[model samples]
Each structure stands twice: as structure tokens, then as C-alpha cells.
Target: MRMVAVIAAAALLTASACGSGKNDTPPPATVEVFTWWAEGGEKAGLDALVARFDADCPGQRFENGAVAGGAGVNAKQELTRRMARHDPPDTFQAHAGAELLDYIDAGQVEDLTAYYESWGLRDVLPAGLIDDLTVRGKIYSVPANIHRANVVWTNPAVLAGAGITTPPKDLPAFIDNLAKLKAAGVEAPLALGRDWTQLMLLEAVLITDLGPDNFAGLFTGRTDWRGAPVTKAVNDFTTLLGYGNLDRDTLDWPQAERLLIDGKAGYQLMGDWAAADLEAKNFPGYGWFTFPGNGNTFQWLADSFTLSTGASNITGTECWLKTVSSATGQQLFNEAKGSIPARVDVPSSGFSPYQQSAMTDWKSATQVPSCAHGSGCSQAWQSAVNAALRSYSTSPDPATLQAALAQAATQFVRP
Candidate 1:
């Protein structure tokens, strides 16, 4: 009887252990990260964020879904497919402006207003940022950082070779400097890349020089796309592109970057991300300045990530969402990215000389808005603008192009 009782007690204990809530399996966490930042400095920025997620949020894992191209052609295609099938990436990057409303309208995006309130993100971030990220009183995205879009990047040697000791402070002087460089046997005045990236630089110049209000007018259809301001911006951009040695439609962004990196080109109009390439090459004494706006106001741009409707809870995805938003995560990520964190309070001491100056300029601004592509306009609106502008840049047919722009702004996008 004693032996039987002991055996019975052991069986009961074994059963309790097997059925105990503590001993039951704990579910794993995950989130898929979809982005187009697979190469150059973008990868380094991504790695820093990944490291943080792993350290702080155990058991969560990321499926690194990356694709190439400045337009994020592949990434956007994949996202569209997934959203169509009800299987979207946990989170994805989009220009912070009105570019994201399409997803929200499709009901494929989650309203992050609650998350913002719960985490105090609204109070922590700046008012301009809150306005940019929020649509119709609900937040759907969080910007990772602010990438100044109209920076002219060059090596000191290129400037010195042109017999110019200093960059020009105004548009005419800048053009004269480029001409001097070209006359000095410089192969290219600017290292302009092809396709969508090429168009982005042109758009940045038009927006900045046209003034923030007028720039917004172009996107919101308050004003038509012509007149002295628009014409001058386009003409100057075309003249600048004409000086490039490489074909404007074929040069890849990386190859174009090499022109400035190797001191072969006088300069390149690019986003702050260009600094990432400069830093990686250990390229010395690089210079950065806003594209001389021809005595007009400087309008810039921004980009961010928005979680898809069902993406917030995926293990790896959720970890990254938290990791990318936190103060520590943003600083570490943006430092490698050659950008300043979007958060207002992150210390700027670690930034490079140019970056520090840009940060100062950005913080003091009362009305920094988006460029055409990065503007809260849909891709359809941008595409029509892109087509019309591309045609006008090469063909000089302003009448036809201006009419198209007016139509594009007034019509509804099929997308």
C-alpha cells in the first residue's frame, strides 16, 4: 500500500507539471521589415536598429525584406501584392507627407494615434512633425529622421581645381562656379543620376527656390505650374544637368556618387544620405551646402515608416517598431545614416560639421515643407508631374506641359 501511494503521488505531480500554465509553450514574437535600403550606408543604419531590437526584445526576429532602386520600385511592388492578399509586411517606409494616405484609405494601414498617445510620442516630437505624420487627426506613421534633400556634395579638391576657394552663396555665383570648373577641364559639373533619383533632385530645387507656400500650391493645386519662379527653377536644373559628363538617364546613383567621391565631378545635388557614402570611403574634407536657391526660400523634404494594419504585433516587426521610434534607437540609426534623428531632443554633438549645421538650420525653420515627390501628393499626381517635367526639361514645350500639370492636379488618381 505504501509503494502504491508513492507511485500515485508521482503520477499526480507529473500530470500537474505537464498541464501547468508555466510549463506550457510560450508563443514566439515576430515582424517583417520591408524597405529599399539594402546597399551603402543604409545597411549600416539598418544593422544598428536590428542590434537594438535583439538586445531589448528577446524572442522576436526580423525577416529582412529589402529591394533596390531610389524609387523603392521592388519594395513598393511587394507591399502592394501583400496588401492585396491581406498579408502585408509588418512595417514599411514611405515619404512622410501625403504619400501615405493611399494605404490608409485602402484600410491596409493601422491608426497609430493610440500608440502615439500611449507612448507620449506626440508630446515628444515637434509640431511640424506631428502635422506631417498625422492625417485627419490620426497618426499612421513615424519618421525615422529628416534627410535634407537639396544638399550639394563635393570634394574640396574639385572646388580647388576650379580655382574657386569657396562655394557660392547665391544661384548665379553657383552657376558661374560650375562653368569655371567645367572650363578648367573638370569632366562633370555635377554627378546627376538617372531615372527617378534624377527627377528628385530637380524637384527639390524647384520646391526650395519657389518658396514653401508656392511649393505647397503646386501639390495642392492652389497655383498652376509655370510663371517666372517655376520656369527659372526648371531652366537652372536643366542647365546643371547638361554639364554632367554621364548621360542623365543612365548613370546609377552609386556610380554618380563616385564622381564626387573620387573628386572627378565638381558636385552632386543629393540628400544628406550622400554623406554616408562619403564617410564609408574615408573621403576627406567633403563639403555640403544647400543648393543656392537663387535668392529664394529653401523648401526641403522628409521620409518615414508606417506599420501596416496587422503588422504591429508580429514578433520581429513589433520589436523594430519600438526600436526605431525610441530616442536611443533613432540616434544610433541616424548617426550611421548621415542624418539627424527626427526626435527634437536627441543630442546633435555626434554629427559631422555639415550635419551639425544642417540640423541647426532645420530646427530654426518655421515652415519647412516637402518637395513634389515627397509632398503629401499621391504618386499619380507626382507621375503626371514627372512626365510633364521630364518632357519639358528635354523638349522645351512649356504650353503642352503646363496644361498637363493643371489636368493632373484636378483629376482623381486611379491608384
Candidate 2:
């Protein structure tokens, strides 16, 4: 009987050990996604992508580490801090071109070339875009969406009230319209925001004064910043700024956009993302046009995702990247994001009319990279330009600003 009791006790002990072993198995990993999409249409787009991730990446939890700031100014600062401390998120949003070169040079991101092949991304994304994303023949990130930076959003009622029936076709006409709107009792005829928004305005004016090739050449050191064309662009930029809000420096893009939305301002020069914001707010009858004189050119930027080198959840990170690059994921995100899918295979049937128009333009327009959005210039270069503009904003010295910009290009432009 004692022997029988010993056997039963041993069996019970074994059963308890087995149960404990089962309980000790680790839970699925959570993906910590870092971005600067904390509000408005950008946030909604992210949320939709997260929902898709939940369905496709089952067993993985999604953690949002979004920071709030227009143009990712705050988020990029925070990300720089985190990366310096070696606390990288699983995946982070990055502009696909020169901005990503900083991380690549630092060896902070992984080479995604093999994954691209496995996922057949090479076949789906545009060949020109693939060339732009590639650095020394290796791609480091996957593009999520393509955004047009030179779009001008207008409040139709404000325009009609100012007796403006058609959009301006050139810089002279644009300035004339601004004057007309101001004379019609609008306090701020052109909506302006922080430094980046101003930088965008400057770039649009450059395209107008310099034409597509010369404007693009400015980044490559082929166009002279000290020349007459750029000077004309700077003068035009200043003229346009005169009609902007007196309190512009304190406002973010969304706040500036609100000026147009509420019918206080006639036009806002911003990215295509404003369309999504307008849709989200249920604002209708909004009008859009390419920045005056940028009619045949598309100033483009792409929001992409990078795989951090030391990500805590490699599986989850890979899952997130795959989902973001997939056609369905791009469709879901772009439909609500006010941008077009990076993948060419994604259909355009469900996108907003503005987006559909942008899609057409994307195919036929002369595409150029946007310095304000980190495609045409490096982060350091962008910062330098922003500093110059900020000082110019307060002091309004065109010569001094032009000199500073030329110095920045000399320092940051690569051979």
C-alpha cells in the first residue's frame, strides 16, 4: 500500500510540473510602432493600418508610440533621443529618401533587400521609386504612401466672396489674387504656418521662378542659389508672406488649415494630406489647385517604415513592414490618409476625387523631390534651411536668407 501511494504521489508531482511548464510559455510579442501621426487624417490612417495588422499579424499586439507635431518636428527630435540611447522602437516612420540616409549611414536600420525580393515588392513598386529608395544598391525601408507637397487647398466660398472665379496660373497672378482677397476684407488672405510650411511655400515659388529642371537642380548643386532666378523666387516668397497671418509663427499646419476651413483665409499651401483632414472633419466644397506655376510639376515625398537594427520584436517588426507594403494595407491606409499607395498595384477606384486627380498628375507630371519634406535634402540640410527661414521670418532680409541657404547647400549637399 505504501509503494502504491508513492507511485500516485510521483504522478501528481509530474502532472504539476507539466502544467507549470505549459504556463511558462511566453506570450506573443507586441510591435511598438513609432510615428508622428497623433492627430487628424494621419492618425486615422495609422489606426486603419493597425486594424489591418491585427487581422494579418494575429497573436501580435500593436503599440502606438506616436508623437504629435506638424511635419514630424517633435517626433524626429524624440526619435533622435531614443536612438542615441539605443532604445529603438520595432519600426519607425521615415521619409524614404535623403532623410533615411542619416540612419543608414549610422547603421541604425536593417538592409531590407532580401525581404523585398521575398515579398515581390520589387515588382509592385515603381522602378523610379525603387531607385530613389536604394542606397549603394541596398534598400533600407518600405514606402507606405506618396504625398504631393505643392498642393494649394482653397476655401471656395472665400474665393467666390473675393470675386475670384479661377485659380491663379503663375506667381504674378497668385500674388494678385492674394491682394484681391485681402482687399475683400479677409485679414489673412494666405494661410501660413510654422517654418516647414514656409519652406514649402519657398520651394513652390522656386519651381515657379526657376522652372522644374532648375528648381530640382538647386538640390544637386547644378542650380545657383545666388543667381537671379532664386533671388526672384525669394522676393516672390516674401511678397506672398506679406498677406499671411500676423500670428503665423505660433500656429501649426492644422491651425493654419483651420483658417481656410472656417472661411477666414482663401488658400493654404500644404500636402495632399489636407484632403483627408477635410474629409475627416466633414468639410465640403473645398477646392484644390497645384501651387501657382507648379502646374506641370509634382513636388513629392514618401512616408516610409524602417526596421530598426536592434528591434526587440523582430518577428512583429517584420510583420508590420510586410503588412504596410501589401496592396490591401496600402489601399486601406491611403484611402483615409489623403495620399496615394506607394505600391503601383493598388487600385485607385475608392480614393477621394482629389486623390484620383493626384494619381493622374503623378503619372504625367514632372516629379521633383521636396526639400521641406526631407526627400530633396538631408535632415541636417533641412534644419539649416529652416533656421535661415525662421530668421528671415523675423527680420525679412532676402540677401541674408539667400546667403544662409547657399551656405547650407554647400555644407550638406553630397558630391
Candidate 3:
């Protein structure tokens, strides 16, 4: 009987051990990444990023929650709904500067100050970028890539066809080049998309007209919106629009780029993301340069991911962020995305010639926040500007546009 009792006790202990083992099994890994990168090179870059995450992070299933719209319009709208319902994704894409402040203000994002330190990012990223990303002594997102917004992409073959032997060096040269291209039978001398693309072009014009400091001052209340500098920018933008495609109001940036790629247009002034798209197409003889008269300045925008406050898979989200923050991941993703890695320490050998040039410029160029891309101004301010520009495009009047923009700025520009 004592022997029987000993066997029974051993069986009971085995059962308890089995139960504990089952209870200790790790929960299933899942990560949902949200972004507005739904097509073209942006999607390709995102796929490369997810593939890296899949390879490095075993057993984690990644969910791509991509929404399509220009400048993250649809994605932000959907994200607003999700955040309101308290059902946030593991991570969401956001522009890295004042744009991120909105999420921080709503307490919808987690503080990543500790992660930045632990990951040694503080040493790798530019000090100015770090300061821009930080607010109230804490950072809230991880920037993946830096894009230059003041770039002009030209098809060398088209430029040559248009009797242009050399790219333009300054604003007057650019205008003359457009005239040459038009005389050479080009319908669209300057390819432009809808509202935001016009706004992007306007920002570059503003920089050339106002210089980097005053261009920045527009947001800080240091520069007068109704002053001569802004007035000149508005006039230049109106003149530039005269060279734009007839269907400028109908096409998105991608469609506008198609005009340049097909040799129907001589130049496309857009962010470096367009370069990535061109690279993906393997279109040879394409060249890039900074906006006219703004060679020394970098109108910058960055794509960053923020940790959501209600993330159901914090571990998986952190794993994804760590992977993106790694050098290998940055190189792979940036190669596909047509942008430079945020980490200045990353090797530039993997980048294309255009990207290599951009990286070199990024190191020494005077950095200016891209107002159209959500870095230089608040969302409200940006929206107001966008509205004013849309109306300005329809009217194509400099004086009226200046007045409207100044009124909009007064309403929203806090500083």
C-alpha cells in the first residue's frame, strides 16, 4: 500500500509539471504596421522591410495595414478612427517632426526616449534630427529614412531632345530651360500633380526666393507672410504653374512622374521618393539635382514609425522597430525606397548614384523642414496652407494667393 501511494504521488507531480509547461508557452506573435505606402517604390521598400523582419524575427506574423492616398490623407483619416476607438495598430507611420506632435499631444503614442538610448540611436542620427524629433524631453518615433523634397528629376534623353545641353543652374536658367523645352515641342515642361504637388513645388520656390532662414521663419513667425519675399515666391509659383501640364489638376505625383519617364515632360520637381520609383523602373539616363538656387539647402522630410499606446503586441512591435533601426535593415530598406538612411553611420556604397549624392549633401547641407510634408508646420497649419494653395492654383494669381496664405497663416501659425 505504501508503494502504491508513492506511485500515485509521483503521477500527481508529473501532472502539475505538464500543466505548468503548457501555461508557460509564449503567446502567438503578431505585428500590424500601418502606412500610406500602398504602391510603387514605397510599397516595395515596405515589403523589403517586412521580409527582413520575417527573417530575423522568427514566428512573428506581420500584418501590413497600408492605406492609399496622397500625403497620407486616407491613412491618417483611418488612423484617427482607430485611435478614437482605442484600437491602435502595433505601429503607424508618421512624418518625424511637428507632425508627430499631434500624436504626442493626444497621448496616443508611447515615449521611445528609452529605446533611443538603449539602441544607441542618439549617437548615429544627426543631432538636429534628434532635437527635432524630441519634445518635452522625449522622442516618440523611430525615423527610417530621410527624403529631400527639393529635388528635380530630369530625363537626360528628353532634356537633350529639348535642345538642352546642360541642366539649369538657377531660377532664371530653369525658367529659360522650360521655355526651350516648350519650343522643342514638349507639352509639359514642368510635370506637376494635383494640390500637394503644387504645394511641394511652392515650398521649393519659397526657399529659393526667401532663403533657408526666412523660409523657416514663415512657420516661426519671424518672416512676414505678406512681405516681399513671400510675394516673390507666390509670383514665381504662378509662373512655374504656367509651364505645368494641362492635366496638372487631374494627376497624382506618380502620374506626373509618368510624364517625365515617357519623355513627354522635361522635368519633374518632387521628393527623392520619385527617384526610387525611377530606379525601380530601371529607367536609364535619368538625372537629379536640387531645386534651382537652393543647392546648399536640403528641404527634408522623414518617414517614421510610432509606437501606439494600445498595441496588442508590444514585443513584436519592438522587435520590428529594432530590425528597422539596424544597419542592415536601413540599407536594404533605403535601397528600395530611394531615400537615405536616417543613421548617418550607415554605409553609402549600397545607395544609387543619385542617393549617394543626396547622402553627401545631407551631411553638409543647410537643412530646412518641408512645410508641405508635415515637418515645418502643424497639421492644422499645413491643412490651411494646402487649402489656400488649391484655391491659388485655380485662380493662378500671386497677389490673391499671398493674401489668402497670409490669412491662413495668421489663423493657425502659433508662433
Candidate 4:
């Protein structure tokens, strides 16, 4: 993919090009960014980063090529079409780990290892996180934030009203808490939304039941999918789902969070990104706890930006990547985005109370990759698991779900 070819192909998809020449006077430099963050705190974070870019690089301009969709549902589809047509943005957002394999395999992304070295990023970012972003000893992207997946958000007023003195620390206690919440007339004790949210809840349960080693093995091919632990986890997930909202399937993550905020629900098991949303709303009486029995663990997901192969403005793209990896850029973005900075050196003063705790926990916790958010498995495997779980949601059968998950592993796992 090259500029000439991309420009030629862009004629067919009119709104796809960075320099479409719709304006009589083109900017001296422009970095067109493609992402799924169209609304909420995520967009605010992007605007902050763009502001940094504008201030730092006087001549350069930021072009938002954002498409609206939760979890990049529509953006990914359009990005695929643009990439296939050899018309790619200067930079595009993607999950950091194995989710990037598809772009790398297709030769649609550029290696960013040299940039990491030149910018001294190896010293600023955690070594383990940097290793996760690298493939075959080379890097391809700059991680903007680290999101913790296995978090339980609580409305303090709701919990205190139900006479729950403390957050659950184990599976048994968690179930008991749910029962207590239900007994208190809380209609949705555990608020869940859509298929991805369901998967997030299921993975948190799997981590609690299987322990960190076994859970990590599920992704690394060291754990047997048909084993009793997996079976028990599936059963546990089904039991957990019983307390979810009746209209979960129709709502997205934010809507489900509303149940918790509005005092209609007691708990929500979601990523730290929810904290940013809550903070933006000046949400009071909110508290957080690690998901049951997973206190010493962190289920990690990172959002990163990659340089596309056929960028029209390499200089502008490089400038964007530099800003993304800079300490100032990371701190400002993560403070608004509700995630911890990828740069470990950033001071904790920039984060909110919840985010400050997460930053402290990141150092000591045993990190596990997140499948629901694209760190633990390939996109194909994730799709398969999602299908199986969505089916399980309707059927509510544990054995069937376990068997289906085992089959998906067999098909997607490599030798």
C-alpha cells in the first residue's frame, strides 16, 4: 500500500481520505486519526490529546475520522474496507496485544520499534507491558492507556441501604451479597449489558474460580478447555447471570452502568473505563472493589495507536505517535479516559481517587490478559467465544456452554 494507490482508491470511497482536497486551502500538515471513540469520556480524552498535538506541533492539524460504535463495532468494519482498498488513515486505534496480529499479518501496519528506542519509551513504560505490545522482537504501536477488566463498581448508597457492610472478597461471599441485594428488593443486583459485558462478567468469574495460572493458561494453551475447572467456571457464570438485568441484551455498557448509578442495581462488573464516565458525571457515593477472589490479579486491556502502511503524511503521523507516547500526552489523556497511564513514571497526582488506587495495584498485582477486550485471544477466537456465550445467555445451560467453548478452543488454538 502506497500513497498513490491509496489516493486513487479513495476516489471510490469519497469520505475516506485524509487529504480529500474538499477545501481550497489544505493545511500544512494533518494527521488523520481513526478510532471508535465518538462520544463520552473517550472522546474527551481524544480531544485533550489533539489539543496537546496542536499546541506542540504548531503547523500540524488533527483530523478526527472517528465513527460511532461501542467496541469499534462499526469502525472496525469500515477500517477493514479502507485497508482492503489500500486507503488507510495516517494512524488508527487498536488493542495492543494479539488483536494487532491481524493488522501485522496483513502488512497494513508499520514497525514502531525504532521510535520506541529513539523516544526512550523503554525506560518509561513497564517492561512487561512493552513486551506484550511487541511481536517477534519488534513493536508496532504506542499504548495510550491500561484498563483493568476485573473491577466491581458499587453505588455506596445502594450497598449501605442493603445493609452490606463490605464488598465481597470470595465467590461464596459474592453470591451471598447478590442474594442479600435481591432480598432488599434490588431488582437488578448485578447489572450486565449486551454480549461483550456478559463475556466480561464470565471471564471475571473464570479468573476467580480457576486462579491466575489456570486462567492465563486458557490463552497460552497450557490449560485444558474440557477440564473440570472450566466446567465449574461455566456453571458459576450461569449462576451469576441469574442476578443480571432482564433487559441486559438490549442495552450497551453505559446504559447498564445507569442501573447502578440510578440505584436500581447494586453492582456492575466492568473495566476501569467506567470510572472515567462516573468521574465526569461527578457521581457521588461511588466505590470500587476487585472482583471476588481476584484481588491480587489484574485483567488487562490496552488501547493503542498504530501507524498505517500507506500514510500520506509520515512526518505528521510520527508527530502524533510521539505525542501519544509522551508523559504529558499520557497523563492528560488517562486522567480524562479513566485508565492508568502506560508510562509508569507519571505521578499519581494526575489521577482520580479510584484511578490512584488502580495505579498502585498495577505494580503488585499478577496481570492476566483480557479476552473480552482483545488481549487474551485472537479476534477469531473471541468471535467464537462471543457466539457461544450469547447462545448460553438464552439457554442458560452450563454444560452446553462449556462444550461449545472447548470446541472453539480446539478450532482456534494453534500447535
Best by TM-score: 2
User: lDDT score, residue 262, model 2?
Assistant: 88
Regions of model 2 farther than 4 Å from truth: 1-26
- Give the C-alpha miss distance for residue 51 in model 3, angstroms: 3.1
Higher-lDDT candidate of 2 and 4: 2
Candidate 1's error at 258, in angstroms?
1.5
lDDT of 4 by residue, 79-195 (tens): 999998999999999888878878888999999999998999999877778767778888988899899999999988888888997888799899999988999999899999998
TM-score of 1: 0.88
Question: If both were scored by TM-score, which would come out higher, candidate 2 or candidate 3?
Answer: 2
Best by lDDT: 2
Per-residue lDDT tens digits for candidate 2, residues 20-81, read 99677778789999999888778889999999999999879999999988789899999999
Candidate 4 wrong stretches, greater than 4 Å = 1-26
Q: Give Cα distance to truth, residue 77, candidate 4, Å.
A: 1.5
- Whole-model lDDT, model 2: 0.90
The deviation in Å at residue 98 for candidate 4 is: 0.9
**Candidate 2 all-Cα RMSD:** 2.2
Q: Against the true structure, what is each candidate's TM-score?
A: 0.88, 0.94, 0.92, 0.91
- lDDT order, best first, reads 2, 3, 4, 1
Q: Would you list the C-alpha lDDT of every candidate in the order shown?
A: 0.72, 0.90, 0.88, 0.87
Cα shift from native, residue 18, model 1 (Å) = 6.8
The stretch of ten residues in a row with the least summed lDDT in candidate 4 is 15-24
